[model samples]
Target: MKPDKSRSGCPDPSTNALQWGIKVKSSNFLVIESDASRAQAIVSALSFLGYRPVLADRVDADETGEQWRGAFVGTVEDEAQLEQFLASLGRNARNLPMLVAADSPVATSLIADDARSQLIELIDLPLRYERLAEAMRSLQTRVEPIAASRRFVGQSGPMQRVNALIRQVAPFDSSVLVLGESGSGKELVARTIHDCSPRRDKPFVAINCGAIPAELLESELFGHEKGAFTGAISTRKGRFEMAEGGTLFLDEIGDMSLPMQVKLLRVLQERVFERVGGNRAQRCDVRIIAATHRNLEEFIERGSFREDLFYRLSVFPLEMPSLRQRLEDLPALIGEFNQRLVQRGLSRVRFAPSAMNALRQHGWPGNVRELSNLVERMAILMPHGEVRGMDLPEKYRGALPIEEVTGAALIAMMEEQPMIADSFAYGEGDPSVLPLEGLDLKDHLAGIEIGLIRQALNSANGVVAHAAKLLRVQRTTLVEKLRKYGLSETVQAG
Candidate 1:
């Protein structure tokens, strides 16, 4: 069969991708040509070079900026249409590198002059591999850093605020202090800022102030000359020197000794530090991003931490919300962990809705790190399986902020309340059957108990003791459970 030809007499654009073999070194780009034949031609070019290209039509269906690395535009579009397309990308995508494939000077002249600065190049078309490859290399340089921040995941309100703060401060050379509980992803936040900042290509050096001995920490941050100490056989560069033009992440900053804090405060003020046992001052050009689980104010009040140092490190403060606080992001976090596990040669495991409820109920004192560990464990235990409530570990099976209880506790409670169990559900369908999403045993048991209590109370005219007798439980136990659930406030003990 003959191939479809455009009005301009060009061969079918769809078949052009096979013209060049796919290779690995290119990027995913948006094929921004509005003309159907032209869009297909752009796609074919991208796919040929191992580049994933999304056509202009796909942009209308899903406008997310994350999937696109850059764009390839056709100058054939009117100036108005081009402006509208760029505007549709929104502020998050405003910095995207764009390329225009023009057939002639007339087409190139149609693009706005200011817009020309934003484009990587306005190369003559017919999609030459060498030219397109170089353009993509430039595009990848910017896209890779933007892609790094994608790992710092969360769509929850708390995470949005954190993300907004990161965007606001990342462009400027400002000291950032991250305050959060241990295992709350403080390092991840610091790394994200560096990745998204102007110094993204530079090295990101991290050191734990508390992990190093007080005597060694000074040399660690400011470097040391040869023979400065017993172990200093050769000159060594500290984190600050190594980081140079990038970021230096000082983890557990609050734990630095008072003397060490004084030394650090001087470096922040002067932007210079001398190597240990060397009088020569070294310049400090790196941005500092410090984090600590400890409260700096409390340490200052206790006279353990320097108040001056606290103010210097906190030009911008970021607080990471605990996993329990952002329960809505839990599923996404689990899915991320599951994908990571898959990469590590383990089959994925999914959580049923009822199982998810149980996981959400957990207080998550260890935060995101703890949740990651749990996901890995689940994948190891039940590879490629959908985990239900009962399948969860005892600890994660159930726990509320107000009350801590596990699957074992729920079972014990049910056994102790034999009479209540007998009347439970009143033979409502098959008790053994689980819903499509499964069931949270703790919540399911609580619902049945509460329903039976309400029935007993109604039957006994809302008298606590009478209701207790009807349910075959001690009056005191019934009263306590009623208060625990906040079911009723006014009821006679009799």
Candidate 2:
């Protein structure tokens, strides 16, 4: 339990604090160590570093409140104790900086898999003050905020307007109805609103109304007492109770049946709901944030959705733009996806100019989710390479006409006069050739050939064999032509 002096340098914590320019006087740190001697040593180090250390055998969520700056859990032996300790801290402390000292594999695995260890500093056993100081500094850096809007990507006009609306409404507890296509980040918007709101410290629970069955949806939204139904074994608190003083996101709210909608409307109006098979009514204190892809107005017209409920939910309506509406954000989104891929141990990839253009032209019916799926697919297919025009799917490639021009005819035309390529429009209004003063047949034909090859390759999505078929040429012949024009670098053979 005592500090191993053989491995201790015992550097002055005050000097480290001075170097960091940290004016730590009453800054509290909770140290959870079962061993008294080791705990004392940690407490002494924290005190020397200008921090007040509170030594405890366990973490008490209600006891610490927001008083403790960070925590140091030394040699966790019991999983149940750790889980309970972390659960007590609730969602607010999920990001709290923690340094866990462990020597056993079981402890290491437990911490690694636990969501509560998100901001874990280290798992090095026999804690050292030097590493502890580093973690403290790092955690302090994370405490600073750049901007709330930076949490979301996209600087498009539509997105800018959405961000503005979010900033304006986030401070209040008014009901918000987020309208967007599927995969358009409705849940993200709800979370952002909650994060920017006064109830950020409380839990933000989410449930998909459409995902759960009508028979169980009522019980899911409202708590069910033991023996409320056939499967009700114990008293369980629903999403409303779980959310408590925070926010409850009802995604796909339009899909909630008429009976469920009526119940939800009552809760919204009266701010109270009773559990299944229970007479006691629970007050609803959480803010409501609902999202849906379905048009509730149309649903109302069809007598499927309640008009009163729609009005109740649409107090502060927010519409999320589709991916097609925000094409300008594609590059930034791609960059973010690449960074994510790299983090996942996948090779980062880039789209060629033509490939990007094709993506921009695409009609993204599924919105951002579709784009993200495409990016993930491309990452897997072309893990360590560039995505060229030929790398796109066949459906994404626009139609290109087959131009039949012989090399000899092109050379003859060029030889006759220097071609002014800019002045003459190819395959435009007039089918008959225009009288030109100058024509560069070689350059014109080469450019035409390159353009055709690129278009074919794009239609084939970088598949050399398929592109060859599209161009009505042999694979070897296309390969030779590609090499001759230095276009082989743009093509990936499947």
Q: How would you encode candidate 2's per-residue C-alpha lDDT over 8-64 as one tens digit per residue?
A: 654443334422323434436766666766666676676656666655443433454
CA deviation > 4 Å runs, candidate 2: 1-57, 60-150, 399-494
Note the residue pairs that clash in candidate 2: 390-461, 390-462, 391-461, 414-441, 417-439, 418-438, 418-439, 419-438, 419-439, 419-440
Model 2 error, position 364 (Å): 0.6
lDDT of 2: 0.72
TM-score of each candidate?
A: 0.56, 0.62
Q: What are the per-residue Cα lDDT tens digits for candidate 1 across 1-494?
A: 66445543454444554223233123246666756665666676676566666654445423454445677778433433554454444433344677777563224433433213433566666777788878877665545433442367779999999989999999999999999998888988887898799887565767888888999999878988889999776666676876777788999998899889999999999999999979998888999999999989998899998888899999999999888788999878877776666555677888887788898788899998898888878888998778877678888877432233333454466568664455453545555667677665765667577667878888888899899999999998998787666556646558
Query: Once model 1 is optimally superposed onto the true structure by TM-score, how far is the C-alpha of residue 302 displaced, in angstroms?
Result: 0.8
CA lDDT scores, all candidates in order: 0.72, 0.72
Q: Which pairs clash inside model 1?
A: none
Top candidate (TM-score): 2
Q: Worst 10-residue stretch by lDDT in candidate 2? A: 399-408
Cα lDDT for residue 49, model 1? 64
